[model samples]
Target: MTVRGAGIFGLACAHACATRGARVRVIDRAGIAAGASGGVVGALAPHTPDAWNAKTAFQLVALLEAEAYWAGVDARSGISSGYARLGRLQPVADDRALSLARAREASAAGLWQGRAEWRVVRAKAGWGPVSPTGWLIHDTLSARIAPRAACHSLAGAIRDLGGEIVIGEGAEAGAVIDATGHDGLAALAADTGRPAGTGVKGQAAVFGLDRRDAPQVFADGVHIVPHADGTVAVGSTSETEFADPTATDALLDDVIARAVAYCPELAGAPVLARWAGVRPRARSRAPMLGPWPGRPGRYIANGGFKIGLAMAPACAGLLADLVLEGRDAIPEAFRVEASL
Candidate 1:
């Protein structure tokens, strides 16, 4: 099997196929993790446990599968992908939000089926954003992984499994899967004569702080992910219109400011890195997975938008099932026809 784009999605798919005893080859023009998957912030968060739907249910399965999936990658590769199930904390700003959070605790009980807990609890020191209500939505389902390291880790795992990743070389052999991210989305839009999808630029920053094993904090619309490498990542700016996809500017500074305001403990931490990338957003605003329309021997695995990393494990598994075993377990909402 052949896969295009050596980012997280492609690498994950390649690795999954190899683990299943299929000889795989991955082709990427810019090399591994050169796209949005190269970003520093890796928040494997889930949707609210309330208002459950197909998308939310799918993501819940993915988040739960992450621990073992990443652990397998780490074990095979002997490299750390900085994955940990540290959970997440969200501040309760007011009584209204607190009431909603409490209500979701009940919903999570039924929806999560005891696999994880999404409960309302008192805010813990240095574990979350300041809660005006002194309450927080603490969910044990959330996790984190270092995005860039994860790509390399997956690549190494594939190599160890006798799979190959060629940079700007090799022809598509057997089945061809396109996980080419934003570039793939653009090509699809051009070929279809309509907007299939577009890229949204996101900017994020890393801070020099030792806060590993802490729950990720989401407050004031900013994600504060504490990585296992002892550095904290705070992000991001979702800009649909940006002149430069890879340039960090005042918007990033504003994001950093917001992050600091949310977590005062990070105020003194020095800036470690500033990064930006474009995330693929399909017209339907959901994952587009299935055979490439009007193109035989081709498949697409793009349009992950904001939740690409969180969804990668399941996405790769489903795509591999379809491409290799001819099994189609892709959710109807994620089908390419849905996006079209």
Candidate 2:
């Protein structure tokens, strides 16, 4: 099978197909993790535990199995994806938010299938966010993976599995999977003469801090993810309109300030890197997966949006099922037709 784009979606799908004994080839004009997947922050955070549905359920399954999936990639590749399931912490801004959080504890208990817990706890110092309400919601389901490293790890695994990765261009052979991300979305929009999907620009910064063992923090819509490589990443600003998708500006400065404000311990950390990228967001605001409507032997795996890294493993599996085994296991909400 041939997969287009070397971002998390394409690489993971290529790896999945190889695992299933399918010879695979991946073509990416830009090298691995050359887009959103190359960004600084990698937060495998879960959706709110309340109001559980197929989408959230799908993410849950992915988050729960992420450790094993990434570990296999790491083992096969002999490269660490920097994956860690250290969970996440979110500050409660007020009584109302706290009430909702506590309520979700009940829902998460049942909805999460006892595999994880969502509970409110007294906010603690050091490795935590500032909470005016003195409370925080901590859930065990959230995890982190180094975005670039994960893609490289998967590439190595694919190579180990005897799959081919063609940079720049390659002839299309066998079933074709278009995980081309933003470009694919743009093509879809042009094809339908409607906004099927578009790029959402995001910016983030990395800090030189060894908080690898700490749970990630989500405060005031900002994510502070601590990777296994001793660096902490904090970001980002979701801008639907931007002059330059790859340019980082003052918006990132604000996020760094907010991250430091949320976790005071990061006040003096060295500014390691600032990065910007565009993510593919479908019109349905969910994963866009399925065959091209009128194009046989072609499949799509895009629309991961803010959750691409988090959702890649499970979404890749579902796409591989359809492409390699002729099985359709994708949820309707995540289908390409949904975007159409």
**CA-lDDT, candidates in order:** 0.91, 0.92
In candidate 1, stretches whose alpha carbon ends up further than 4 angstroms from where it belongs are: none
Q: What lDDT score is found at residue 162 in candidate 2? A: 97
RMSD of 2: 0.9
Error of 2 at 239 (Å): 0.9
Which ten residues in a row are the worst by lDDT in model 2? 188-197
lDDT of 2 by residue, 113-198 (tens): 99999999998767899999999999998988999999999999999999999999899998999999999999877876777888
The global Cα lDDT (0 to 1) of model 1 is 0.91
Worst 10 residues of 1 by lDDT: 122-131
* lDDT of residue 176 for candidate 2: 94
Clashing pairs in 2: none
**lDDT by residue for model 1 (1-340), tens:** 8999998889988988898999999999999999999999899998998777788999999998999989989999998999999899898989899888988999999999899999899877755788899998899999999999999999999999999999987888888989999999999888877788899999999999998978999988899999988899999999999998999999999999999988999999999999999999988889899998889989999988999999987999999899889999998999998888
TM, every model: 0.98, 0.98
